[model samples]
Target: MVSELCFSDLPAEAGQGWPRGGEMVGITLEVQALQSYSLDPHYAKGLHAWFLSQVEQTHPRLSAYLHDGESEKPFTLSRLMGPFREQGGRQVIPPNTPFQWSITGLNPEVVDWLWGWSQRLPAWLELRGSPLQIRGWKVLFPPRTYSQLLEQAPSSGSCSLSFVSPTSFRHRGHHLPLPVPKNLFHSYLRRWNDFSGLPIEVDLFLDWVDREVTIQRYRLESVKTTAGRQGSVTGFIGCIQLAASPRMPELLRQQVQALLQFAPYCGTGHKTTFGLGQTRLGWLAAERVSTPRASQEEQIAERIQELSTLFLSQRQRQGGSRAEKTAWLWATILARRESGESLEVIAKDLEMPYETVKTYAKLARRATKNYQSV
Candidate 1:
């Protein structure tokens, strides 16, 4: 069945087809698969690269900052949101089905770049060799400045945040899948301090947050998924309701409200660039109410993790960063090959040389055989 597609000019609500005065903005692009295709579980990595390439084509300096800046990324991307069917362990998207993909800018420079680029967006978003036709685009989050965000925040009430995609924080050397209140606010506050130009004393504010902010209600689930090019991540996708103590000063309360409003634009945790932490302002009923099976990406991640564990156990030297890294690389190459991806494609996706990937696959196979023989 052919889906209804929008090919008209930007809607009137979009306001002048660009951001007003280059403020923070989030947009949803209406896209469709040009033909029936089996999408890779880790397609978000390709989408991330494609976006950076687009930025590089015009604003080279901004692209470099977005790519290499040690600071928080000025943007966030959402996984393609639409209908898909699993066929032979892959997500199959039907032709001409409407899909939504969101991109949000955290600062004025990035927002301005988005506005200019949207004027001449390419007809298709190239994902590896498969292409998704760009049908239409609209501003999903209204544009606003950091000061404006703070100034316009509501004076009183609880804030609810919905994490629509897998969201995790880097705590110490590992991924923290649960959204502890302090960590959740820390994520939002870091972005605000970096781009908002209104820096709050981190220790002072977070200490107050720790003592005053409380999770009123929560419904969360943790899932393991593969993202970017390397290791797997364990993250949570759910909704939480939080309230501040009434005894808190009104000034601090307003800042809390502003940061919560900023969550959708800045996202909630690490790897926001690769579609890992898609957040929204209000409670998402679907997340709270429904239970979901492991996604194809999560399933693939599980397989890789299982294989990595087996591979690590066989290694003579089993406890260092290098050993773990090698085990993961071998496991990833083998798992993708078993899933019917070509070696060259796997090499490209992992950013490894073709020869290196081929050697790892051989080594992984030999190791697997030896283990099974015992």
Candidate 2:
């Protein structure tokens, strides 16, 4: 059973920015396995910290598992995903307005424990060291079941996605700075492998790639990271349609649907703790695209990847590791240029010479044209 609860009459500023370092726009809760519960806002106010501390005191084993999980020794849980809501129907929550937190868990024990906790809700919910009275809360359970999901799952190997929040990944030792088709699906497959508790074969999942999945109509943009003063997150935040090869197995296609549902809750990439990667199913070619539109910068990032790939393939202008570094640098600049970022801003952010970025942008454009004409 999944229950959803809503809390209103929160401090407006709390919604604008809570959990100061979280650097998130809306409210979200990262509680594990509560059948379904809703929490009100703020991390900056130490509210989340207090709540977790209480959990630690009351349920040390469960709390420890959620904070950090290890298979052996100190045994903790690492698969902690959260619930969040930024909009209610057509109306978007205004900044500093009250926000809602949706809590859910598949485990009945987790749900029972959480539901008990909510029953003991104090009269006042504290924020940033200030206490505010709870307006009201009601348990809600909408129809969400395995069968319902099965009905909604895509019948074909093809899938479309919309990254509602910044979605990035880690490839090799570095953050995958771009949303490539391989990285995106591989990340999904990895998460499913980790949490699905199913005996899925890695080769079988990889085989889906051999079917030649293609990505199209994507938009990406960079979001500021609150982790550090200069840190930023580059992620895709628009519609991307993926077409699978006909050779894809029916089982794999079914898995794709489950993966899509999982992506929204589990998120897609690194720094999900700070709310970086969020996604959902997107417009198939046949469906009318929704109204929440992509930004101009996002649209440019979509095409910029194709342009960058084209540029690199043609010139091989530089070779070796050093050459690879140069190619990435140029690709970064070209992407930003296409997104309409000023060379000066790009230079300052990348700590490069303005003239150099301008020159590289021009070269990239030329390379793109050269590749296209051929």
Candidate 3:
């Protein structure tokens, strides 16, 4: 079943003194109905990993931030889902199946970055170590407005949301984490309030403190994530409809709706970069949605390819295959520095000597400066 929820451009800064275009705004782009040649239940996870590699290949800066978010995540990815035929209880997306995927940029720079790549539609997506041609793309541009969440609450004084993919949390608990209403909404609210580049009103803050949740209907099952050195992400997937308690203050209600509207774009919970925590609003207001397609810059794809090749060659020359291992590490350190992540955190995550990571960061900065100068 297909349902649509729309969010418009909401401007947010990339953090203190980050370089960007004058008008900072958050924009989300979705490429829907990508068809593959064969059935693969694991295609979504493969696509997720391929996306990370592609980002690292094209925009190391963004890749680094996604790896090390010192401030807020500049972007989030949702898991791709589509109808699949079952074989011996295994889910297999049929050959020539149409699947949809999206990327949400939290800052104008990210949005502009995505806009540049939109021109090269119907590109090859690597899945299961093979190049799969995405038949075509239906691009959603200009982003939709998320103002419906501000409408007056129903007389029942409640709202509901649906989860279409595996959604989980990182807070330590031995048992599988059930999606709690308050915690879920609070999670979205915190991200929205922290990264949306908007100030929260006093009432909204109070509502966050006072609100509650009731899970109406749900079907949850654990799903393992893509294979990687990071191991696997085991999370829950199902449909859940939650309602707010004590009614909700007007401002609080709107803020919640707004954030929920944007949640699908900025997926909730961990491993989003690897296609975990894909979510969406169950219902939406009746409004005519429209998108503006930006004209593609000429030779942009060629330019991205050129940059990717240069970086790959540089890394290969620096340490051969060994240097490739640290490509993500250096990018993480450099990206985190801009977002305010401390050296200690980066070292721990990369499992490297703190001083060594620092030195690499310095070298990475110098290299970037040199590249730009040339």
Candidate with more favorable, higher lDDT: 1 or 3: 1
TM-score of model 3 vs. true structure? 0.56
Best by lDDT: 1
Mind giving the per-residue lDDT tens digits that candidate 3 earns over 217-255? 665655543312222234566556655556556555556
Q: Which stretches of candidate 3 lie over 4 Å from their true place?
A: 1-46, 56-60, 83-94, 139-156, 173-176, 199-211, 216-234, 283-374
Q: Model 1: residues >4 Å from true position, as ranges?
A: 1-19, 287-295
Tell me the tens digit of each residue's lDDT in model 1 across 95-124.
988878889998889998888777777888
lDDT score for residue 210 of model 1? 94
The better-scoring model by TM-score among 1 and 3 is 1
- On a 0 to 100 scale, what is the lDDT of residue 104 in model 1? 96
Model 3 weakest 10-residue run by lDDT: 288-297
lDDT against the true structure, each candidate: 0.83, 0.47, 0.50
The order by descending TM-score is 1, 3, 2
* lDDT for each residue of candidate 2 in 132-159, tens digit (9 for 90 to 100): 3433333322213333443477676666
> For model 2, which pairs clash?
12-96, 19-43, 19-44, 34-111, 35-111, 45-128, 65-77, 69-76, 69-77, 70-76
